[model samples]
Target: MESSLPSTQILDSGESAEGKNEAKNYNEVMSTLPKVKSLNGYDYYLYQGFWYAPFFLEGLMSVQEHFNPQSTDIFVASFPKTGTTWLKALTFAILTRSRLSGSTTSALLSKLPHDCVPFLEYDLAQNPSNRDLAIPLVSTHVPYSCLPKSIISASCKIIYICRDAKDAFVSLWYFLAKQRRSENVEPLPLEKSFELFCNGIANYGPYWDHLLGYWRASLEFPEKILFLTYEEMKKDTAAHVKKLAEFMGCSFTLEEEEGGEVQMIISLCSFEKLSNLEVNKNGKHRPDTSIAIQNSIYFRKGEIGDWANHLTPEMGARLDDIMDQKLKGSGLKLPR
Candidate 1:
């Protein structure tokens, strides 16, 4: 969705040469950024509002460059803070229970989620070896257009997770605020941040467009992309997990459950279980760019209606109007 932030008015194409030079200089300054290594055998530079790894981009450019999608391959795709952690945990647990055979070490099971389902962005950068981590797992925030061309052509099965925009904005706002506070940078106040969020100015945003891209793709390729919502999953995780397992061609057999395997997986990957794990709580997985820590454990509160705590009536109404207009006729309604 577009951020609600005030729009910047563009100058006419006939602007003076001096103005153009100034604009160029401004862009150059904004684009200057630190470089980091990518998981996919390349370096990435954070610049001009997006992470750019020419090599990784090239890797995603070709479907063949991607890990072959086995019948076992499972991909989790989402915009940030949309219950990605929950889905990752559930997917990992479901896939690995047969191997675990009823292990009670919740810590080990929690760790397994990250090990099994590496995020295409965060985890990949720190551990290049993770690029080739086994099949039945990969997660990404990359928009539909940016996904590997081969994935599209091959019709690889993908799970797209979505959440209520209000809850997403609240969680994202707090997360960013915490990061900025750690860095001693002034946090973006809620009103201003909300405005930017509405305008689609947040990281990897143009949020509506990003969501719509995937929503449309899922509609056109229903067999290939299983569209899921965070609210629905939160309401019935086990059922959704079963659906996901079935979609990925890995449904639990009645025989497996006769051994209590399903419950074991569910207990192991529960949010309370994973969030408290020592490895996740204390581990440093990424470079802390001016912040105290990197890769803060992803298992944040997975509660619904979190926006009620942060959004003012006026702001909420404004957002409601925007949602109504943008999502009109799309059969996608923002949860109240």
Candidate 2:
């Protein structure tokens, strides 16, 4: 099986004459964009009323100018902290199951998901290595409006998974809390963050808009996008794994399934197995970066409705009202 890892050259940092001109154009775009302070107190530029981290926007600019999407490329799209790590692990494991020998399969247990399946904007902006873009597995939290033209023009496959909006907010709140503490900054209280999130002021937020963008796209281009929900995936992970394999054009054969290949992929990527791995528990993902984060930070309590532990009745009710209003007539209602 051929690996989807990126080995293709991307014009990173605008070092060449053509690349430098592209960078100047992006710089001009950045200068005119609205900026806002995110919940973590970092500045994010607003486009279409949603906030995007500056670095991510820079990478998006690079991708727009240089990325030549192959029809076979697979992209995992989601809001931040909304089962992205889980989906990436499952997607990689499923796609690569036939490629690895039994002994080498153990490496999947050790390597972090972000290392195996890179984020399009975040990872590429930081490193600009051909390795990250060479892979078939790519991810992004960038809204549809801001995605590189090549992605849509080429009609690349996008698998978008969303969690219940309320739980997604709780997960974002907790994740940022950890990130801020690591940076020695005071984390925003849940009450305050909740208000801002509802008002659509967080990174990649107006969470409803993010979900709707992909959801509507999936409906229109069923061949190009697969929309999923975290609750639905948790309910029947094995079934969804099979669905994902088929969607990615790598369906397991009867012989493979009969040999327990599907189960093997599930076991390897399970929340319990991944969360407890030493590398995940102790490893820092790109520690040198300003947004240093632990591999374990992606684990958390991967349960449905964990938000109940944190959300007051009033808080939950307010979010529900917003979701209902925003998702009305879209045929998209999140699981409670």
Candidate 3:
């Protein structure tokens, strides 16, 4: 897969003349309408100078109302592209071992993680009754501050997965690049995109604040939130899955051990396995969006320190300094 944005003559949207022209075009394409308040009461911000509704937040409220939080229910939460799909697959396998009988077949596995543990936002928008489906599993990328108060206070378990900001930015860049290209919007140049990302100007960004919010919450309520790192899980998935199972009160049985079910589950949920599945690649869950483009591409690369290939030395140093300044004394550091 092409990881970097294509280098070519393109309009800019920064301080340069070409960038200003691009900005003008973006503004022209977007409606100059007033921002509207969403049903959940958050202000919708302008995207490309047009009022953009946060359908996701609206869906989240719907799911929140329908969710009957139980001690047994598990929620997987993350910032976008922070190994969410992989974590969802691993968690699903761990929780539903008895149902799967150790299979990751396309016929056996759900088309999307959203189908297995639906995104509280997307599903609720697609089918309001979908909220009732959250009894056992749900996943979200909503910031901790934005999540329902009940989820914060309930006995239900939450697993917050985080990734190094550099890698997360690179992954998000590629993900958005694919989306924009598909939508016929010109792709943002890599350098400018990286700058916007570092400045936390992208969608659902201000990455440090998002991660810190969860980190602090987890510290305050350790029993309710289990903070995890993508690097750690990539290093020893089986061990991590086992640890997760233990935390969620679901463990492999002796009979499952005899059948190597734990290892089977890990392999089944591997990046290569899930990314290649026809169901994952071809299935469509969101209206007007291709599953292959949106969900399947989510698992594009799970490699650690992959950002080194994209971020310049100076850029990396700058990011490191910013992270140090923001995360200082928080007892949290990005995994190497």
- Provide the overall lDDT of each model, using Cα atoms, as 2-decimal numbers: 0.62, 0.79, 0.66
Every candidate's CA RMSD:
9.9, 4.9, 10.3
Per-candidate clashes, comma-separated: 15, 8, 2
- Per residue, candidate 3 scores C-alpha lDDT tens digits across 1-336 of 111111111121225675455435434433343454321223444432222234433334344444445556678988878888888878877776765433844322656765677665555334435543324677877678767666666777889999888888888777767766765666677787777666655545567877888899899888878999999888887778878888888777777778888788888888788778777777655545332245555657778888899989898888888888989999999886
Candidate 1 residue lDDT tens string, 1-336 = 111111111112226675455445534543466554322212344443344443333223223233344454567888777877778777766766666535664335445355557665434432334554455578877777666565576567789888878888888777767655655666767877787668655555556666777888889888788988888877776788778888887888988768766666667777777777776676644333221243453656768987887898788778778777777887776455
Which segments of candidate 2 are over 4 A away from where they belong?
1-11, 14-27, 103-106, 125-129, 132-135, 288-290
Clashing pairs in 2: 4-135, 4-136, 5-134, 5-135, 6-133, 6-134, 6-135, 7-134
Order of candidates by TM-score, top first? 2, 3, 1
RMSD of 2: 4.9
lDDT of 2 by residue, 252-290 (tens): 999988988888888888889889999999998867644
TM-score of each: 0.75, 0.90, 0.78
- Lowest lDDT block of 10, candidate 1: 1-10
Residue pairs whose backbone atoms clash in candidate 3: 12-19, 13-19
